[model samples]
Target: MNRLADKVALITGAARGQGASEAELFAAEGARVVVADILDDPGRETARAVGGEYLHLDVSAPADWEQAAAFVRESFGRLDILVNNAGIAPPRPARFDEIDLAAHLRLFDVNVHGAFYGIRAMLPLLELGHGASVINVSSIDGLAGVGSMASYVASKHALTGLTRSIAIDLGPLGIRVNSIHPGIISTPLVQTVGPARIARLQRTVGRQPLGRMGEPQEIAAMALFLASDEASYCTGAQFTVDGGHLAGPYREPPADPDETLD
Candidate 1:
């Protein structure tokens, strides 16, 4: 149960969804967790539920990142894991040419630059652990394209690149870095895109190999593995938790004739 015993983890966007799941799971495994999010009330509640400390953080703001890192340093004295999980998808679908410039920029600010800021700000504490780990929560959009999610896809792609680059730079120092790509998980984030659209997306997902949407805990499981010593030799890897969405289009095989079997 104590896979992460003696560790300290900071998870951004921990008020809900995959981040909250990771925080709870990490705490269950005996790690001291810091839940950072802009939602003060929900964040505090999540922290209380998980026996973690809550930090108010707007990942797009550099000063917030600095404050969050400082809080972790002062509270825990060292950091063992950083989960860059704060991100925002566009509220509604828009074509490439129809997307608002402000929305696009905001998506990058939180999804891409936020991770960058977190890694830089937490480096000192992470280094203090001597063998810390970083988990960047990208999306299936990061690995492949989804029509109308151009900005989110681009931002996640940038995050994946950053993961690889930093892994190379930090590997010699004993810090492992990796990115996770989750498929359509049932989370509040889905509400932003509207129910009609989400309904259609779910129908599509149901046709995939797993034939179902994933739960937050499933992705949290991946984060836990990446953060643990079990993955000591793993770094700069892209782990996709999608339900075989990337395997290929689901197709029914042709029926075979009895003569063929004979």
Candidate 2:
């Protein structure tokens, strides 16, 4: 529908996976997209394929965000959408007690602090636009607890909170903010969790109502909605696109076992 016609969007971590999927979809919907990522080669390739531009963005660095914001302002004059999608999910600790403090700190630095900087850096441009939206990529882990990966879960939870608070603060300025809680999608990061770990994840998926993982495009579709005018009233909301992973109770009692089967 060209919902994003004449809009300019900046998507971080757009080299591959969900970020890349969103970039492609946004461009197709008539938004001029800027693919930003630390991975130079793939970022450029993906941007080229989508007929967009690629910028080297290290989300962990505040200075990088400043430069990126300036680049967008000079190039596009205004920014209508910002997607904080760059993140890392390190391997699960051998045990909860084995969690490395340094690793946890680094995770928060990227997942939490990076989003903070992105929002701050783009505020000027976003406010300049008639209406703008910020889409933060959170995870289902942010909503629930698991046996391992406490640190990663903690970071996502923080991001979700940040998203809500920002939405509250920015809504008056016509800038909407929202978080997306994605369940296990087929991404390289998930593959790196190893076969045994993947088996455990599969068991979790089997119990979900949909009995499978989600696709990147599915998440992108929700993102597009949130970024478009269709979601004009959807700020500070957490949308889950997890193949029913967040939906409660897939099992039902043996129906009418004691009653007559009509």
Candidate 3:
């Protein structure tokens, strides 16, 4: 019941979806949770429900990270876990050549640089805590190519790289950095891509081994395990909760043999 007893956790994009699930689960397991997000009203509600603090943090802004550092330092004195889960999905499905540079950079600003800023800004407090862990939420796109989500795929790959590099840097300091690659999680982020995109996603996911979309809480459970002492030796690794999407392309179910007598 007390997997994270007495810990302090700060999670970005905690107002809703996977972030919200992580916050609620972290609080339930005894971490003093801090919900950080640009969504003020819902963020506050999440914090209240979890018995945590809500900080309005725009992850793309360095100034906002500075404020978050100060708030964490003042409010908790140290932080045991940091979940850099705040990220933007592809603004629109565009082929690599057709994507606008500025639009692509905008996704990188939040999806890539947001994690970079959060890790840099929170390093001190993380070093101050016991068994500190950093969880960067990447995606299935990070591991492989997607036709139209070039920018998003690139950003997630950058984040994955960051996780690996920083793990080595922080290992000596007793901090572990790892990335989570989630596939087709049912979140508002995905919902924003519109009905047609969603239907396409559903059809695609349906062909995978699990044949279903993942839930936010399921991702949160992986976050919980990494945040806890259970994953002490784990660092600079990619944990994929992808429902076998990466296992292989879908194939028709072959019929069983007509006779088996062994």
> TM-score order of candidates, best first?
3, 1, 2
Q: TM-score for each prediction?
A: 0.94, 0.93, 0.95
Q: Distance (Å) between predicted and true CA of 139, model 1?
A: 0.7
lDDT (10s digit) by residue, model 1, range 1-262:
9999989999999999999999999999999999999999999999999998999999999999888877887888989999999999886878888999999999999999999999999998999984799999998889888788788789999999999999999998899999999998988887557779888987778667886788999999999999999999999999999898889786442244332211
Candidate 3 lDDT, 111-202, residue by residue in tens: 99999999999999999998999999999899999888888899999999999999999999999999999999999988788889899998
Q: Which ten residues in a row have the lowest lDDT in candidate 1?
A: 253-262
Q: Each candidate's lDDT (Cα)?
A: 0.90, 0.90, 0.93
For model 3, what is the alpha-carbon lDDT of residue 140?
A: 85
The TM-score of candidate 3 is 0.95
Model 1, C-alpha of 146: deviation from truth (Å): 2.1
Q: Per-residue error at 65 for model 2, in Å?
A: 0.2
Q: Best candidate per TM-score, number?
A: 3
Q: For residues 124-231, what per-residue lDDT tens digits would candidate 2 score against the true structure?
A: 999987579999999998899866688888999999999999999998899999999999998878878889989988877866777677888998999999889899
Cα lDDT, model 3, residue 144: 96
By lDDT, the better pick of 1 and 3 is 3
